[model samples]
Target: MLYIIGLGLCDETDITVKGLEAIKSCERVYLEAYTSILMVPKEQLEKFYGKELIIADREMVESQSDEILLNANSLNIAFLVVGDPFGATTHTDLVIRARELNIPVTVIHNASIINAIGACGLQLYNFGQTISIPFFTDTWKPDSFYDRIKENKDLGLHTLCLLGKKIYEPPRYMAINKAIQQLFEIEETRNQKVYTTESLAIGIARLGSSTDQKIKVGTLNQLLSQDFGPPLHSLVIVGSRVHILEIDFMRFFAVDKQLYNEIVKKDYGI
Candidate 1:
């Protein structure tokens, strides 16, 4: 049997009881490292789980999956993923491939940023399409995501922007500042005025980590100057038709509550 386990957000202890049992019974355990990461290091997880893990980078998972799936017909194999196993489409593809090989699969689900972003006090149902903001290069800046955000805005729905991360290389994590800058640049080029410097946004850093998590709510310009200490940050673009309750709840995390209120009233007309 092949087990695809979700490690949840945060550290090793965040694994579900069923996932831990599966890990203990598995003959070989592979940790998928490229999609997202845990708050703790590999060694920490190994120490906690009492199992040595083989790190599966993007290359190995995509190009050499058969090697990882080897012997799964006879022996139990575990493929661990940060957040939920199905969070990334790559993992879904792997499951499809396993089915083609007639390998029985078991999935263990857990909390991911997709749902956990509600900590910012935004209603999950009110969110439109979720978009990923990739690290922009001088020659290749993509604004396709901006159109999605605009679509969400047009419908009075919030937009969740999942920042990009480059793992196994120099390790680049997109900051909220850079995301806002890219959005502004896209607006300048497109001139649709989907977003502006005074637009309200919420920046979350190191989410699900008890010790280092931070939440900041303010305008795009206000957040650009704030320092969100560590990696794994996400940005939320506030829709113009925000609920009063959401504004009230998120005000606690606002950089300046008065300013947040003023902007919400003036720009969002809430």
Candidate 2:
């Protein structure tokens, strides 16, 4: 059997009990390192699970997957992903390949930012569409996600922006400031108030991790100067103001205390 296990969002301990059992039973374990990352290292996971893990970066996973799947039909091979197994489209393809080979595969589910994003108090049901913001190159700045954010803002729905990530480097993070600047540039070109520097937004970092993980609420312009720690981050553009519960939840972070009142004043139509 081939098992695709979700390591959840944080560290080694985040794995579900069932997933842990599956990991132990497997003969070989492969961890895909490209799509997303965990706060803990591969060694920590190995120590906890007592399983020999092979790190599969982008090149390995995409170019040399045969090595991981070679004996899957005869041996129990396990492929691990940081979040839920289905979080990335690549894993879906792996499943497709397994089926084509007549290998019985099982997907072990766990927590992922896709669903954990509700920690910000934004109604998940109210989100219109999710978009990603990639790094803007000097000659290739793209605002393709701008229209999607506009549509969501027009409907008073929320837009979740999963920030771009570049691991294996020293700096290794797309800062929140850069994301805000890109949004401002898009707004300037479109000459639209769909979203502005003062527009309410949230920045999240190391979401499921225990240390230094937080959700901060502020305007894009206000968030421009703030520092959010770590590489894996996500931003949210809010469309509508609803219950007081959201405001309360956001207050845990300084940005919310400093900005949400103004956002509520404007977005709530008070």
Candidate 3:
């Protein structure tokens, strides 16, 4: 049997009871290290899990999965994912390959940033599409994400912009400030007025961890200057459909209370 388990967001202790049991039963356990990461170190997770974990980078998972899946038909193997197993399409491809090899698979579900972003007080149903903002290069800047944000704005729906990271060559993660700067540059080039300095945005860092996680609500201009410590950040572009209850909840995390209110009322008309 091949088990794909979710580690959930944050530390090693976040794994579900079933996931832990599966880990204990498996002969070999591999941790997928590229898509997302946990707050604790690999040693900590291994100590808690009581199993030696093999680190699986992008190349190993994508190119050399056969080795990882070897003997799965005769023995139990565990593939651990940082968030929900299905959060990334790469895991789905793994399942397909496993099935083709006649290996039985089981996936253990857990909380991901997709649902956890509700901590910002935005309604889940009000969100349009989730887009990823990749690092822009001098010769290869991508503006496709801008269109998704514009579509969300046109529908009065919120947009969740997940910051992208390269596949662990240098382990660089996009910060909230950098993401905002990239968005502003995109707007400057396109001039669609999809978003602006006065547009409301929420910058979140270290999500799912109770201690280090930071959630800040303010305009792009307000949040661009604020410092969000550490990596693994996400940004949310507020829409016009924000509810009164949401406004009340978000005000607690605003950079400036009065300014947040003014943008919501004047700009969002909510």
lDDT for each of the candidates? 0.88, 0.81, 0.90
Best by lDDT: 3
Give the deviation of candidate 1 from the true structure as CA RMSD.
1.6
Candidate 3 ranges with C-alpha deviation above 4 Å: 168-170
| Colliding pairs, model 3 | none
Residue-level error in angstroms, candidate 2, position 23: 0.9
lDDT of 1 at 69: 91
Put down candidate 1 lDDT per residue, 1-270, tens digits, no spaces: 999999988988889999999999998999997777787899999888888999988888878889889989899999999998766444866787789899999999988888899999999999999999888899999889989999999998999999886644544689898888888889999999888898889999988888888999999999999999878899999886678898889899999989987987787667
Model 1 clash number: 0
Kindly indicate the candidate among 1 and 3 with the higher lDDT. 3
**Candidate 2 root-mean-square deviation in Å:** 2.3
> For residues 1-270, what per-residue lDDT tens digits would candidate 3 score against the true structure?
999999988999889999999999999999998877888899999999999999998889888889999999999999999878876445866888899999999999988888889998999999999998989999988999999999999999999998876665645789999999999999999999999998999999988898899999998998899999987899999988878899999999999998887877787576
- The clash count of every prediction, one per candidate, is 0, 0, 0
For all predicted structures, in order, the TM-scores are: 0.95, 0.92, 0.96
Most accurate candidate by TM-score: 3
lDDT (10s digit) by residue, model 2, range 97-155:
77888889998998887889898887788888888787888898778899899888888
